[model samples]
Target: MRTPRTAAVLVPLMLLALGCAPQNSSTATDTSASSGANQTPADCAQGKTMKDGVLTVGTDSPAYDPWFSHNDPTNGKGFESAVAYAVAKQLGFDHSQVTWTKVPFNTSYAPGPKHFDFDINQISITPARAKVVDFSDGYYNAAQAVIAVQGSPAADASSLADLKQYKIGAQTGTTSLTAIRDEIQPTSDAVVFKNTNDAKTALANGQVDAIVTDLPTAFYLAAVEIQHGTIVGQFQPSAGQQEQFGMLFEKGNPLVACVNRGLAALKSSGQLAAIEKKWLSDTVDVPVLQ
Candidate 1:
């Protein structure tokens, strides 16, 4: 774990590390609690949330799977949705007491007030982001994977250095794009799209030789989106150091400590693993790009 010279942050490590935890758009660094909780939040009062007696959660509309299922976060079928509820349960709210709100990916951490108690939209806990927003303990550690159509130049690559000649694509303002620049440093400028779907389309149409995304979404695209799609490979970012996703709260939200307690409970109880296994695929078999 990285220590910010100016901050007091407690970070955790995972033995099951692989791939780049390319987030929706930031490098990760923990900025959560430093102490433990009493099984659950000691306070469940409504004042801790955006709405009294309810836990207001925010995510982008059309929330993607396996982060969110059927574009309906209220159903709690996706990985993030399930984790949200699990954290809520630890915080003393049932599914009924939790509510959902729509937020744009960029607006969720733009350095102003937030509209939800916390947001779980694959946002990474970067030191830069932490300056403006508060993050719960990391809920998911992610990996980066690349996808390309069969016979494409990228699909033939065997290492990170081999990818330098291709045009890479990723959603605008996402850490996938950040990963492209920081990891690949391609000979040509990486292509930026409005969203993942657009990048997927560009790759399928041969507009870009390859696309980079979190490993799970890469697997999803290979399964259903790209015709004759193949996983080029997976790579752990920053030389195998783990990057993670955390629940976001408005800066100085006291509820942050409460949420950290809930996350701690999930980790200690093995509930977190169950949720992740149900939603995310194993990365053990994907070859490391370099």
Candidate 2:
């Protein structure tokens, strides 16, 4: 049964999800030219960037593990960090010619002028957000996973149906929360936390039966953060829609095209896949919870 506390959490989550849900309108910027086969490095580097003679990149502060190593996006060690440098290389910028800045996750997509040439903090490409910001071609495809205490009922859940009655939690404003409300649709409203660390704490304290996060982060959390954490399973995006991470830019910025071109080159050369294998290889083999 749903408790008063859970009910309080659900009301806001449902409203936020409804407010941010992707719209069907054709407002997202077109990327056909940027992703075309004939795009060249010189063409991609033609646009004015945030900094002269340098590629200014933005990511969240204290970047987490598996994404940015040791909270340093400048080291070019983690997956996103490495991909950033690779994309810069394809855009004709050398390793030392790129610069890093800190941009919070929520502010990266908000409507406004941006401070970076491109921001890459695993910001998912969504029509709703694209209305306010330009997104380059998808750089990574992602899936959501459920994490629970090792001996809990949620840990034993083999399918979506098996998880519907348990108390679930996820970071507010993330696709993980949307998945809980729209895909899992549990009997009670899922708790929303300020961040992944908060959700992890809730799961550890038994405040929630389980928490949802992206597959790679789930693997990391289950194996390192939470002593008894175990991933129950993973699920594809709801309604056959693929959730993809993209680089973000200011609305109508010409830089989007250039970044898209660089991303295309990375994808064509298999560098993206290689980087994924290096950092997120543990994300494989989790059973699909239908």
Candidate 3:
């Protein structure tokens, strides 16, 4: 009964009504499945790791107090140990999935193939070092501290100028030694030792009037390791820029990005601050030397 024009109009209206109708159950399910697939987290796959499904971390042996308690890096008791684990967790590895290897402090940044994914041993980020190795964003800002035996002349010193007359010792290849040579500019050459234990011994035996170490190490040495040891004072960082400690990586390692992401998340979540408070809090009372 309708003309051809009416028929054309009616066909379109019917089609429009059908199109606006509720979706069938199967189509609704398909739409939800597609949306859920897109919402999943991006794959931080284990294939890119050093060993399949395992994260290998490196630190020096006899890892000192506040950094690695009792020389153990696996227990997560020390600041560096705790930080290593937190970063591993961020990379989708559980504590059990991590393995620690003993890598010497000096050897960590050497140009060559590396056996571990990354090393965290208070290694400072410097341009020269960066040429041979990669470094993550700094996890801790470091201050140099002077440690002297109780009743020694160095202990009575109130400023950098006051300490310049005495001999200072520090571990070789450390910022502590650099601080002594450059910041303190002592009358005699800064004594360099193979390790911190040697420097501590030198300070105790009167071979050196004082020793310089990072502030947290100074606290631990005075409080626990060295008999009659006292922290003379902490030095202000050179040039008003705080020295920072960063994790070391193989040159051009792709894993650096992944580890950096982990570090970023830990910092954002307040976990890094919590770890600092737990291990390095003893440095709060130490006086700053001018």
Clashing pairs in 1: 20-143, 20-144, 21-142, 25-175
Clashes of 1: 4
* Consecutive 10-residue window with the lowest summed lDDT within model 2: 10-19
- In model 3, state the lDDT of residue 278: 68
lDDT of 1 by residue, 166-202 (tens): 9998877667788889998899999988878788899
lDDT score for candidate 2 against the true structure: 0.73
Sort order, lDDT high to low: 2, 1, 3
**In model 1, which range of ten residues has the least summed lDDT?**
1-10
User: Would you list the rank order by TM-score, best first?
Assistant: 1, 2, 3
Question: What stretches of model 3 exceed 4 Å from their correct place?
Answer: 1-42
Backbone clashes per model, in order?
4, 0, 0
Write candidate 3's Cα lDDT for 23-132 as tens digits. 11121101122222322111343456689889899988778777787788999987789989988888888999999998888788799999998888877666567767
Per-residue lDDT of candidate 2, residues 1-290 (tens digit): 00011111101000010002232213335655644457685465765677778899998865767777778888998778998999888888888999999887767788999889888887767877887888777666667788899988888999999999999998777888888998899999989987788888989999999999876677667877787888798786656544667778898787776776776667777777777666655424578899
Number of the predicted model whose lDDT against the real structure is largest: 2
TM of each candidate vs. truth: 0.86, 0.85, 0.83
